[model samples]
Target: MTDQPEPGGRPDAPRLTTREAAELLGVKPETVYAYVSRGQLGSVRAAGGRGSTFDADEVRALARRSGRREPSPAGGDLVFRTGGDLVFRTGITLIEQDRYYFRGVDATELARNHSYEEVAEWLWTGELRPGVRFTAPSETLAAARRTVGALPAHSGSTDRLRVAVTAAAATDPLRFDLSPGAVLSSARSLIPTLVGALPVLGPTEADGGSLARGLWPRLTARPADAPALAVLDAALALLIDHDLAASTLAARVAASARAHPYAVVSAGLGVLEGPLHGAASGLAHRMLQEAVDRGSAVPVVADHLRTGRPVPGLGHRLYRGEDPRARTLFALLEDVPQAAGALAAAREVVATTARHAPLHANIDLALAVLSVSCGMAAEAGETVFAVSRTAGWIAHALEEYGERPLRIRPSGQYTGPRPAQPLPHAP
Candidate 1:
């Protein structure tokens, strides 16, 4: 077969390869295909029909149009629930039969043996190399402490955490490296630094311990007993990843743009501050506290139902029966004296709710109970959640980094009024 000029191509028209077109548009090759599929740009078969070539002028025109204004569909027809459909694919974690599996290993089972660091390393590198450790550099920890300590005493933990992460990113000279090893190193350092820098109720010991044990003193003045520490460790493992949570999606989007690991974590943390996400645990904590004070779980649940608000710790959209994470944690608390009151209240709430509906306790509710049992503050549950889920965010960010860049951009649907025509002025 002989080569020929592209059909309808000008004799001197410039052509661009797929990679060149992607560069011009600041998109991935998959996105370029998306543009072609949507008829936003044109392409022709290459010489000998080997591959496709794009018209440089056409590609440039599309870029200019995109730059001028955001593109939108004709009508506001496209809609997807926040957790409804599978918008993207992931190999990190999966939700099946009301249980979560990380890389095909049962998370609840893994929690029985692995620490948060092991689970995090498994998620990041796809290997569960035993004896692997994650430690923050002395300088990074010092920087984080200085940054967090400067925050106002009344500042929320999340706000202080945000500032600390920003400072950590600014101090790391290798923040721009996007390679896998570099990204993993940054995540390892960032997690430990963040935990160590937070304000603590007591002095933290220098002795080597699990991540949960190290974080215990920071969350409350409660003694770091083995049972309590184990519960916290299991919670951390279970919350490591939940398959494309809102915060995870935000992190992935940031990573798609090649943002540094710290910046990607910051993005995830920003989304997690919302009540519907990370703060759900705080609401559950308050409810449990009220139940304990009132000496009855029925009244508290009844009041919540009467107020037309969903019980904070019960009912999950994805799980039909019960959250396995909640079940695992609740079971662990059954024999602990410190958690006795909180556990009793939780049971009563569960029994009362089951009479009226099919609702069951979720991970947030379990975390709340754990926080109260350990005598932590009302907002302490959210802190645990944010810290634990940082592992998942980093895992998802790494996954997105390996995929096509900028493939998460969503098309908008315009519903606003059309542009107005100019009117002639009278003299």
Candidate 2:
């Protein structure tokens, strides 16, 4: 069989050193030798037979099958994996050395320098339109608002957003146009529509305003100061994409089946409701709020441990150090005078939790600080995440639509009872 060509379309790729192969496979060098011995891997003798070199593609394949590979350091390969065994080659986002990039540019830098709409446009297309703005069409916005208004009075923001997506899809005559241009159009509109459907808490901004400005009124009654708006916009851009998150994987799966851009977003929103994925910020918000209310983080931290709940917002599995998103947002939050009390509570919680295990604050905790300080509801972060991540879902859909249809369907490794056992009679 012909070897699948490398990512650059090269047939003769360079081999990997034993140490490099071991790093990719997440095993020790000795384990690499063991795999070679068991015929599970192939290696070539180095110049004097003093070392071994393995096929680069073979090592990567084993990493995928075993579903384990350590996060590469900065200056390493752009690709990294987490969340599951299935892997898709993507050019969208890369996280390495605790920093993430969008389309190969530093994401945090993009957030700092550009607007959310501008960064999202660059993610979908390589070109950056410096002053790009996304506006929801009146018809689509109307449809979404009608659907959202019909929801039960106590519906959370995510629930309303999900329902709004369906409504927006129905209003769009071209939603099934999955071509690149058409998908980008849908994405540009859908994001703003999702933001628009939420009930406004104060005087509304023009629908054509910057997305962060448009979103501010929906999230809270308090008027947004410039610093607070800066934090919100940065949060939106920072969250535009994280490679192959659970929601993003769901979006890719739908796109693999040729689902329209709206349907793809719906699939992602479906997965976003889970506590582990999107609700995490809401949990962190409540914790920070409690700590602020009680004037100390000690009892709040103790309460979580006493009740068998891990302290929220303290750790992230992906980052061994402080979460970069958290670090960036915390730095920005320092400029917001009103954020002082909640920001202090967040730092106290981190210091308190570090006594037992040294865990760094994740994005959820930073979002919690923003929400608690700004007087936004507990779920405001979720709303921000869902809206920002719609751009990522569309980016993934564009990639998936280019591949062979249904290519993402993985075969099940069935472990159930053997087939055709005698049927049991009714009990």
Candidate 3:
């Protein structure tokens, strides 16, 4: 009467029949088959013409990851996969038809029409405040500066920033408050603190003005100019957020666990080190610098291809055309007279790489042009990226804090030996 295997048969075997697998996973048999077709779960056909069987352990693991227990009030699962990416419901930003938006407004337009602070304020709340300035608290800034100053002399900007944020967190009594007002207050102070903690390399002191103006001196020794500062401001605004990036996902995970806003940012900063994320701009900066030195992008492009490393600063997974951020920044770079040579080098690199594959420039390449022209270090782009994206990470944290606590957990697939195997006696 039961669906179990016949008596004397291996009913409790590691391989399970389709019905047994479905029961364990809490999904319909059809859904289990869908998982197989998607390669999310593997199945083996029984001997001769019998039905397919699945690994019992694998099925349980999938069940734990899927976590598809109850239907929503509308009779559908709250979370579902689309094209192999987890989609989170958010009202903050949207990318559609190759163009991205912030709260339904074109992001590039927002960057162009408003200051970075104004744009960040809009992202945090629906209202926009013109000429807004995020001033750091005296005690927080002093603590961050003291901690950053204590780092090694050759420490990168990102390293100093990480230490600064940790120190700032320790000095704030209300850092644990998750309310919107408190979080926004912390964000305003934290952004300035991160910028203020950096060593000033330029004549333009970070005393008063827009955040971009404050950041300009820290990135380069050159004095700030209108056109150059414009590009930097737009770059900051454009880099604010890209829907659920690797670092943003990490930040969201931390926020879901009720970690303080500072901890969420620290989590994001930890994941921003690798080539695929924040450091990509630094790589692109090096490439552009080499291209300028050689007076041509041909050798640089050839070297990258010969070495089997995909050319950096070109192509984006999300866009079929040129990255919008890159396009905007490139347009802005045209206004900076000092950036002319670097801009030309960037365009040449695009043309050179296009012969092998039709790929367009991404934000990293545009950032490279700026850094190379402004006499900034290669890691300058990484610093700008980190400072610009903190607003976004905090925005995501705000959203995650409102969600169900600890909802981002996903089970890992186990590929080790069977559970009943004897333990090893020696190393």
Candidate 4:
């Protein structure tokens, strides 16, 4: 056998063995032969003519050309998998060991003591500053209120919020500024404006205090107590960020295009309105209400299970055992006297579902329980989720703004027929 040239070839224009060529090109030896067959890469006869060798220059050239092609998965989807494992990376929030952490801080722990405003500041600035206030200007709140009031009386909370955000953006003179400081300011203002603009049942004692207190009257006619307020605060803190959820991804994609913060939020709200996303909580609320009214969860849960449809708020795709958010919020519910029926229904539903399959109550179930117990509207759970998740959407938008613009663009695989020749144009 002829001796092979050194790796990277000799200074005198060396030849590479087929194996060496394949290694350099990150392909199998068979692929190297295929390239030779296609005339894309050249091969030379060995000294004894028993095996083939590749010219070093030709292999390197082919490698360079291959690197220029866009990287994509087979069948032209962005779906990436290895060994039947699907993976994506984000430095924001992590779901692991049946718990969630935001930038290394335990989310449940944060929810225990922190308010939603403090959590939002933490997620946005990577610092847990206590007593952080998210305040909207008086004029901005007035504009949002005007816009929301103009909507039809039957508009859902999410619809009113969507239009309110647009109106607030239109009124802000600094909205076009995309600087980090400006964006953060806008996010802080936007959250408060969105919550404050909602129609309330009665006057709130502390209108500008905690976010939960401000939002209480809007969600329910019942008065806000410390325990109920704590549950709402904790729910908001826990739901502040959850890795890159679909709505957050949509917000990030919009931010990647340099869209204004309002536009980014609008994009997120658009996706959150879907049934499978943020609206799942509303369905869960209705299901919980049925059990509460009937005084038994077995019949409701059993009927849903028999249909082969997933029981809303019972299972989660990420957590294996109990969802930590649900556990935290439900634990708080024990102190809420009004939530007795809803809490009982939730427990029974969880117990019954676990017997049939490995399912546990998730955050939606907790939100539903909170809503029903507190006399909130049937769709109040979705409102909580949307309002809470807006913090995460803003955090993601800020993160995306710092990345390479338009990096989220995905190429589509054309599956259409070949193009036909155009007919001659009339003179």
On the 0 to 100 scale, the lDDT of residue 58 in model 2 is: 73
- Identify the leading candidate in terms of TM-score: 3
Residue by residue across 194-274, what tens digits does model 1's lDDT show? Answer: 888888896577846678878899899867888888899888888888887899889988998888899999999999999
Instruction: Give the deviation of candidate 1 from the true structure as CA RMSD.
Output: 8.7
lDDT of 2 by residue, 27-59 (tens): 799998888777667766777767877788777
Considering every candidate listed, which one attains the maximal lDDT?
3
lDDT of 1 at 336: 70
TM-score of candidate 3 to 2 decimals: 0.87
- Ranked candidates, highest lDDT first: 3, 2, 4, 1
Candidate 1: deviation at residue 405, Å?
1.3
* Cα-based TM-score, every candidate: 0.80, 0.82, 0.87, 0.82
- Candidate 1 lands at a TM-score of 0.80
Q: Model 2: how large is the Cα RMSD against the reference?
A: 7.4
Q: Which residue runs of candidate 1 sit more than 4 Å off their true CA positions? A: 1-86, 423-427
Q: Cα deviation of 124 in candidate 1 (Å)? A: 1.1
lDDT of 3 by residue, 1-427 (tens): 2122333434455898889888767668998788887767777668884888877666766776764332235733334444446768888889977789999999999999899999999999978999899898889999999999999898988899999999999999889999999999999999999999999898865466899999999999989899999999999999999998999989998999999999999999999987789999999999999999999999999999999988899999889999999999999999999999999999999999999999999999999999999999999999999999999999999988888788776656567886898877987
**CA lDDT of 339 in candidate 2?**
96
Q: After superposition, how far is residue 152 of candidate 4 from its true place, in Å?
A: 1.0
After best superposition, candidate 3 residue 328: deviation in angstroms? 0.4
